[model samples]
Target: MRSGYSAAFKALLTRFAHDTSGAIALVWALASIVVVGMVGAAIDYSRTVNVKEEMAMELDGAVLAGARFLASSTDIDASKQHIVDTFTQTAALAIGDAADLKISPADVTINETEGKITATVKGQVQTAFMKVLGIETMNVSVTSQANYADKYLEIALVVDLTGSMKDPDGSGSTRIASLKTAAKALIDVLIPDETSDRVRISIIPYSQGVRLSSSDASAVTDGYSQRCVTERVGSERYTDAPYTSEFIGGGSGYMLGRTLYYMGYRLPDLIYDPEDVPEFYDRYGDGLGACPTEEVMPLTQNRKTLLDKIDAMSANGGTAGQTGIAWGWYTLSPNWNNLWPTDNEAVPYSNEETLKYMILMTDGEFNDVYKTIDITEKDCPGYYRRGCTSTTTKTWWYEHYNQTTDSSNRAKSLCTAMKASPANQGKGIAIYSVYFNPTSNAMAEATMRDCASSSRKFTYASNGQALTETFVKYAKEIQQLYLSR
Candidate 1:
């Protein structure tokens, strides 16, 4: 009986041990499967999130690109296409250029609503782990918006239509023609508005002198005029001669115009007065005014008229950059129709709304200089050659006709005068200077650069295209600023 009981106990214990072993093995297997499944899902989920994030970033960049293109776009479909194409290209490049991630539409449409540019980018990003779960792709959609800046602009184009500009040799009929194209391009970018006259453009073409329209003469003063006299060779002593105009008092100084140099003569001088002569210098030659023989026109905005004048510009005169720059300053001056417009805030010219700026361009050095030389009985070189002689100069019989008293120094002085004008205090004006076909007159370049508001504003354009490009850029930049303001 004892042996049988012991055998039964051993059998029961063995059976219990086997059952526990099988149950433990099954539990271990289930736990391992759960851990593996969790890890796999985590990896897949993280990948999808990462790809979505990347897609979102790509879409954001696309919106900005699209908005820029849209700014100049005149049509909607074209703008939208540009946005989408950008998104597709960037999306592909971002993901190893994989075919899996792509904007099916390949075009994002942008709309301007309430003064904002808005765009939407849609694309599909293929998932790694999600694909194992039978989900091969995820859609990404993003929207972006950029606010528009100012819209009303006032633009002033300061161009160089000087004698040198008309040369086929200097810039090949290239300067004026390129100027026309660039000007037209700038005009096209004007983005006009009907709600309010949003943009106003003024064109100023200058060379040795700036020619103004007769109509604007009523608002202009003799000080800003680029006139002529019966100019001829002479020393600094006979520089201020009073000569009668071949035409009349319209202007008695600009006898042959800046082209006087080409005609083998000197620029005319103002008449000297005993009171006009300073110990060494005087502002307006004699305190009265220089004797001008050339036609002195005033500022003009008329398109056809201005264009015609520009077409007729011939290169023949010495570079009087001072007068050219002065005219530019005059065109931009708020004091045009007022004595002291800045102080009289109540009735200042409306043209002052835009920023005052000037672009001074020159190919040659300064040739024209005005100084008060009163040849009294004691200082007169000769009876007729002593005082201010209009028709001729002492040099006609004595010195070189085109002899300048240090032209380089004269250019520097003129530049300083323009920059230091009472009306241009605290840099009230922005200046852009160009050195086109410069001579050995190093001071000429220095004077222009020093007077400019920025180094970027100074340029050395070799050809006509470059010459026109400088001014055209100024016009466009001003146009942009004007429209924005």
Candidate 2:
């Protein structure tokens, strides 16, 4: 009986071992390990993604900071270090105790030619749940780029040297004085020193007109030593062409009338050549003061001379903004390149290679001009030519030669001509206009606004401080070393 019971128990254990019903449980237990691993991997990957986003943001901040330093700082090595330190600080703020963050000098590149900065960062984060799956860490990397370049600049400053500029600008300093200071400040920023040739500046200080050397005026004609120049009679008046046959009377030229004779102290022919006087003035000397303003300084790199010229500017005449505009444009016009020194000659207009700028500033209205019509009649009120007038000094040639036009319209017409023509109209010159504390003459202000290349380039300064600020802003804009990515 004992042997039979043992045999039955052995048979039951054998049957249990062979049963397939428990196979599903073993399969499910094995699959659970894989499922847990997948979930852990997802969590680890998500954490890594967040870290990468933070790193991207931090890198951008770092590159921008670095690029700004690169733009303004002359020390490239110092600037690069500053950039790295900035990046490290930014990364630390986002990831505390990130002992594995790595950045190398080789990862940062600055291309001066392209004016760009590129930075690359790589790092690793130890996995938490992923480690259970034999994954010890996840790798993350980010890259960022920025642009910073300084371009070439050519600028012409057309300033009003009218008598009004002598008036107070409500800032303790006179308008002329403030202008000198602001102009000098601009020079300091643009040229800095004589070594900086990236910028060339020409200052055209105008009142009634732009004064030329007596010699230059004498060379324009045979007998007349013209001390003043009027707008050409027709279309040529508004063109960039040389002032050869463009004067009134279809360039018949200003023939000195019969009645107006010189005073007791007969000056040089260039100074006061009468109708009968021979044209003795030549072109080899300084300007004849024909269409006179302070002797204009053409586009020049001489910083000291420019500053000294500005210091010597004294305000004393009527406003002839058109004359100032004409001279300023001439300084930038390649057509008049022969009139300047070879090294200081104006560059021709280009589709992309060159940039030309003109800044016109005025404190009052346009109220003066050389002449608007041909002279056929006139009379001298006094024996001295200086005391003559159109009404009282009427001679047969008086009204004919003394004709005048609306000075404001004359200025506008000149501006229109300057801003028109060229491959891209107005592209040849980027015009900037400033009206300082204008009063009563809304028309003058409107004209000036229209003269600007666009409304965005116009500035109205109500006080001396504002004017100075305006000049500083202009200098910064002219020094356009912008950053790009």
Best by lDDT: 2
Q: Which residue segments of model 2 deviate by more than 4 Å?
A: 1-151, 220-230, 245-293, 372-405, 423-426, 438-440
lDDT of 1 by residue, 135-222 (tens): 6777776566554322333334555554444445254454545556545544444432221233344555543344433433322323
Single out the weakest 10-residue window by summed lDDT for candidate 1: 240-249
Q: Evaluated with TM-score, which candidate comes out highest? A: 2
lDDT per prediction?
0.46, 0.65
Error of 1 at 454 (Å): 2.8
Model 1 CA deviation exceeding 4 Å by range:
1-122, 125-132, 141-155, 168-199, 218-316, 337-353, 370-427, 438-441, 468-485
Backbone clash total for model 2 is 24
**Model 1 vs. true fold: TM:** 0.50
TM-score of each: 0.50, 0.61
- Per-residue lDDT of model 2, residues 67-88, tens digit only: 5554334456765787788888
